[model samples]
Target: MVSVSRYGREMGSVFDLLGTHEPALTAALGWALGRSPELMSRFLNRLGLNGSSDVSDVAVQLETADEAGRTDIELFTSTAHVIIEAKQGWIVPGEVQLTAYAPRLDAAATSGLDTRLVTLSDSTAAWAHEVLPAEVSGVAVIHWSWDDVRDLIAEARSKVRGTERLWLDQLEDYMGAATSKRPVTDALAYCVVISNDLFGDATFRDYVVNQRVYFHPVTGGGWPTVPPNFLAFRWDNAVRQVNRVVDYEIVAHLSERFPSVADDHSAGSRPPGDAHVVYRLGPDIPLPDGGIPSGKQNLRAQRFWVLLDQLLTQPTVIEAREATKELGAT
Candidate 1:
């Protein structure tokens, strides 16, 4: 039987297991996108990637080696010099490994270089950020605290929440005026909310953009119960949208409406199957049927007159200047 957890999106970090010494050290991560070894390693594992001899670690090697000893990293990058430092505990990476190793690595390379230090302790990390100078100890220092790491993770989700909320407000205004003329009491019909309008009809083009969209299973009732599906979008190909996280509140409401309507599509651009109605919310783009919907398509030019009139006549430059002056005086 298909399961519930099947709907979950994979959660990962840039760091993976660094070691038992500190939390950040042994984590998995994909890119040195300036994350700890542990976080970076975890990111890599989530995507199923790892070190191969074919890949270049110039960034890796130049930061790992010490001056006095011949290190594997220095030899591996095949450069004249290498400087990479790994440290743990209250020993202080900035004071000891990074500070000591950076110079040696810088000297080995005809080019300027520095090692990266990834550590576990929050206190040490705080010290690194507050005390460490920009280019000392032969390397450029980047430190991550437990608080920093937690905030980053929280920010990822928070961004989605913020975007969804903002767009929801815009969507309400958009649907009311954009398609209010249509008959909601009539048979079931769908509405597509967009962020920007990017479509044209032979001689004319219109763009009605909205950041959020409200989806409903059964379309017309006097102020129909708020639609269930909400997909937040970020542009990818300038044409396609990505990142569809189903909110728990949204999902809970949806479950109430569609007890059997839930079926998970594969992550990313995979098409939704067995879906009753589909609505996209993202940047402005042209729909297959042109920018105008069924009811208002023919009256678009006339409707444009209505919206345009509201914009031009509602307030003039004189009023704007008066308001501005009044505000400045206050």
Candidate 2:
């Protein structure tokens, strides 16, 4: 459940609504899929289907009723001809769970539909992202977590139907639980950092970013992200390891996940996998080039400078700085 203070006592906020009552979420999702179909069918009618006027819901299997298990939801996007396996819930029933579908999918495959799988759960999706066996090939898999789905649904519904109160309540409930609601860092940064830490290491944008991020969840409401291309993440801590330089080549690593941010925006700019800033504690070597110059600094760097001001306010870093500044400054 989300924080009570953010949502208020009136309604159980969005997070509370879903987190507290998952059955409702499942019901809503079923409704959403039933109406829209799990995979889009807009142009599916054109994608070479057998005797189709307008391709809609080529086939849907609510795995809950199937012998496989009740939690999984399978959808085939008629337009794309890809089977979207909405394998959600807590437990992921490995090889056996998927194999059960092989026969049904193979039969569908014979007709035309391309087979693909996308798992829509929190941790299971993350788990699938990492350990997707080599056997699972020629399939497109996307991981959309519970919170992400719920938020998107709430936002969309709130606007069209004027569920402002529901949306507001949800936002308030979530913020109440959130400890650091500062906009400095991106939304889901904490969740991502922690999830990757527990599961593995962070992928840092997971691809190059060239498109505008246009969505900052931390800012609350629906503020967009700092252009994914513009944002940077560099580590600074008490512990030292790998010269920090060893950690800089992550630019190219994110090409797949954020092609818009990775390819488009960075086209004429610096190549991928390069650090935007030098990230030094002091004005070391006076910044060889591309350094934060006296006045021609970017607004982002200025923001960094503001944080630098706060960093300076830290009693220890400042006390250390005071001792050293008198040594060099006029």
For TM-score, the strongest prediction is 2
Error of 2 at 277 (Å): 28
Candidate 1 TM-score, C-alpha based: 0.25
Candidate 1 segments exceeding 4 Å error: 1-19, 22-24, 30-91, 107-109, 112-120, 124-134, 152-330
Task: Compute the lDDT of residue 114 as modeled in candidate 1.
Answer: 21
lDDT of 1 by residue, 240-296 (tens): 222221221112123233343235332221222221222334443222222222231
Model 1 lowest lDDT segment of ten: 199-208
Model 1 / residue 44 / CA error / Å? 15
Candidate 2's TM-score: 0.34
Cα lDDT tens digits, model 2, 125-165, are 33445444433433444444444554554554444433434
How high is the CA lDDT of each candidate model? 0.29, 0.33
Q: How far out, in Å, is residue 57 in model 1?
A: 8.4
